[model samples]
Target: MSFLSALRRPPAAVRLNASYRATPCRSVSTSIPAASDKPAKASATATHTISSCTEGTVLGGLNWLKGQAPVTALADEEYPPWLWKLLDPKVIPDDGPGGQGEKVRLRKENRKKIRDVQFMKTQ
Candidate 1:
């Protein structure tokens, strides 16, 4: 009998639905003792200390340019008209003869008509 069958694992349908592997997966074993075998861990408390400012400080030689650049706000003129529609639906003018849902339905119908026309055309 197979290892899985000996263990009386769940049915193949259940196993297949889950994270199933054709071959048994190998797990890495460490040399450390199990929790039950090992002694209880002692509580560790960290002690903080502020070091003295010495002349041989490592952070001194770093290159940092001390200057500020002029910051300008991005205007609507800088953005494309389509981007405004994405940022806010209300900002976009629905100039067409129908609403948003109507436009989507028309688009889908147009795609189907194009597909039908293409299908009718030769290979």
Candidate 2:
């Protein structure tokens, strides 16, 4: 016998139908209990509430430095103004030969690159 058959349970006794085919044994009580009988109410037990300001009111050290200067403002100042503006989808020109097609091509290229890297790693 196979390992799975050795571990397998013997089939339960089923009632044979008039056609001589084994039929599934079902319990006589088929009616499910109605859920509407029970009264719907919230639990009485008090649950632990979490506070928004768990880090305390003190705003000194590194936190104070971060709050003083925003990261986006710093990045805007560091890079050219046009660099961030180019990221907007509306700003991108659709007049090119393959406007939407270019995006699909780029996605396929990226997928191929990922697959190639995975294949190389496996080899």
Candidate 3:
């Protein structure tokens, strides 16, 4: 018997469906900036060097990836809740860390600077 079946686990399809239902998808803007200063030809040429492997090659690699228990392998509750949370996209928070501060520090360094300035003013 398969390990999953031996463990009396739910089928992969059912787990995937439950995970999909629990995750909320945010719209990702794919529009490119038209006002970029870089020359279009140069950017296009740079992009040409970045490539995806053949679908067959990717599929072949999946067996190894699956064996390694790739990122989403935590549909099983036997794993830690943290891993389960990460794998379940439906648990995504709209205002979670990645939602903002992509290029910014979330910490309020400004507050520290303000406090320093106030201390100086009082002194």
TM-scores, in order shown?
0.23, 0.22, 0.18
| Candidate 3 per-residue C-alpha lDDT over 6-121 given as tens digits, one digit per residue, 9 for 90 to 100 | 33343365456754332222212233334456776444322111112222221111233345732222223344545323323343344645764421344457677888999999
Candidate 2 residue-wise lDDT, 1-123, digit = tens: 664342222222212234433222211222333445345523233322222222222211222253474212122244455543432356445556668767866888999999999999999
- Please list the C-alpha lDDT of all candidates, in the order they appear: 0.43, 0.40, 0.38
lDDT winner between 1 and 3, please give it: 1
Total clashes, candidate 2?
0
In candidate 3, which residue pairs get closer than 3 Å at backbone N, Cα or C atoms, i.e. clash? 22-90, 23-89, 23-90
Q: lDDT order of candidates, best first?
A: 1, 2, 3
Q: Pick the candidate with the highest lDDT.
A: 1
Error of 1 at 120 (Å): 0.3
Considering summed lDDT, which 10 consecutive residues are worst modelled in model 3? 46-55
Give each model's clash number: 0, 0, 3
The TM-score leader among the candidates is: 1
| Cα distance off (Å), candidate 2, residue 91 | 24
Q: Which candidate would rank higher by lDDT, 1 or 2?
A: 1
The 10-residue segment of model 2 with minimum total lDDT is 53-62
